[model samples]
Target: MSDKKKEIDLEEIIAKYRPVVGFRVKKSLGAANPDWEDVANEIMLNVVEKIKKGEFRGESSIGTFIYTITSRRIVDYIRQKSKVLRHAPEPKPLPSPHEQIEDKERAELIAGAIKKLKPKYRETLYLYYYRDLSRKEVAQKLGISLRRVSERVNYSQKLLRKLIKK
Candidate 1:
């Protein structure tokens, strides 16, 4: 039938589909995004290209095909935006003067707590943490079993945390 075999006219397609596509884009990608208009334009361009390439087979109505394309493009746009957000470098502004003072005070408090620990607990923490030795290495250096080394490290941390909380 000539009706089913009708030519794909992009202008008519745009006129009919623009509102729905724009609505879907705005809904899927929040209005807060400055690039929402660019995304809608990309979707329109893709729809035009696909039509010119004869990708529309008429197995479905033009409205359904356009709807599918619009939905997928919106998803792609959302995913791309999220991906940028996920990997974007966090801004590291300079710490304020009060923050610097607090950091110095906290370091002094922690150092005091470390000094109060028993010699073995203190040395084990130094070797494992300050020297960045593996538990096995610390055990070997300290002439103790791996389990003993682990216990001392854990117990020392717990004691330090309790002491610091005072």
Candidate 2:
């Protein structure tokens, strides 16, 4: 076997997919945080390296591959953030009662409802709502069929509504 590496045009690929990858990363990370662009660049670099190493295997389009990598990178970033929070100093106390009664009460109610959902339903809901993934993309990420993804999303939404009603 020859040792020649498949020469991919990294610049061309980057030019074509950088925006898409950045969009994916930004959507995956909730709009509350910074560093999404940096994460996108890191994901793109890793994807380029994987392509040159022949690890991509053309199972999906380069765009799809980049999206997948960016999604995982966002998840990794969140995990790292949680880890850092665990090691950091305790946060300061909350504001006064008058300030706390604004939108935070409604937000907490919704969050509690979501947490009460079944695991699979919660995962599907989070991927759809928080990650902003399409049904097909959710299927691809979760390794389920597109039809199943659609069904699960609909079912999960119903469950969420019921949970919130109680």
C-alpha local distance difference test of each model = 0.83, 0.78
Residues 1-166, model 2: lDDT tens digits: 1333344456778888988888777787744345677788898889888877777777898778877787788889889878888889545554457856866887787789889878887898889789999988888888899889889878877876787788
Give me the candidate number with maximum lDDT: 1
Q: How many clashing pairs does model 1 include?
A: 0
Candidate 1's residue-wise lDDT over 34-92, tens digit each? 46667888888888888767788889998888889888877887787688878894354
Provide the TM-score for each candidate, comma-separated: 0.47, 0.46
Q: What's the lDDT for residue 137 in model 2?
A: 86
